[model samples]
Target: MPLGADHLIHANVVCSDFERSLDFYTRLLGARVIGEVFEFDAGEDFMTILGVTGGARCRAALLTWSDDDTATYLDLLAFADGGGHAARTAKDTGLARLGLRVRDLAAALAWIEEHGVPVVGGPVTLTPMPGRQRHVVTIRDPDGTLLTLMEFPERR
Candidate 1:
């Protein structure tokens, strides 16, 4: 029998600044904090799971797009000694971006601009099939993680 998959649990984002990322995702992206933020030092099991060496401390919080208990959330993490950043681009070999579906692309763009976040790419339209139109744009969070906001105007 094939292994069945139900749904995604969450996506992990290692942040350069925990507070800044928390504010950006919550205030600008409309995600609400699922619980209080917590901090902990990496234990043996944690280090092994994350594939890291040496001692490390981290702070984390869960953010959800809605109030639904089963909704996918963002696992925002910040390491105390995380060192330098690489600056991810769309062409990066690993995970490059996260896609968010918005109700109105125009309104979302306007709100993001009003909050002083610049659009890094596209307000381009995609017609994947007949009568199916999508508008998408790219923006970066405080930690330079690209988020692709897409709007599907209609269902065909």
Candidate 2:
């Protein structure tokens, strides 16, 4: 068999408040709630995998939406105990920010600004890989995680 599959299934990020994160994902990112799981009576190792304790209250919601027939999902998790975590900033950490290719950079930046989020970078032009022109803008989420919105027009 090959080392791995050709496509990614999903990505998960920890949140201090699952409900609030769920609301952000649904309202801000336009994702739909798919499912949720609570691990209560599971074994110690299983609980650890779920980031919970034996008698802890853990909530996980799967939110998803489709873009061009591709399913984009977000896993919102919260633990009643001190097991929950927060998103980290891309500049301070080694993680690369999430990049979203959008249809309009200006409109996206306006929407982000309307939501009270500040733009970290510009809606300037750039030469993408190879020989294409692209416009990009960066914005920070409520938790300071960076997200880049890229726009590639039909002709520039």
Best by TM-score: 1
Question: In candidate 1, what are the lDDT values of residues 1-156, reduced to their tens digit?
Answer: 877988888999999988989999988899988868899997878888878877689999899987795699999999998867889899999989999999999999999999999899989999888878899999999889999999988831
Q: What overall lDDT, based on C-alpha atoms, would model 2 receive against the true structure?
A: 0.68
Model 2 bad stretches (over 4 Å): 35-56, 67-70, 83-87, 91-94
Model 2 C-alpha lDDT per residue in residues 87-106, reported as the tens digit of each score: 56655656657776777778
How far off is residue 15 in model 2, in Å?
A: 1.2
- Candidate 1 accuracy as TM-score: 0.91
Best by lDDT: 1
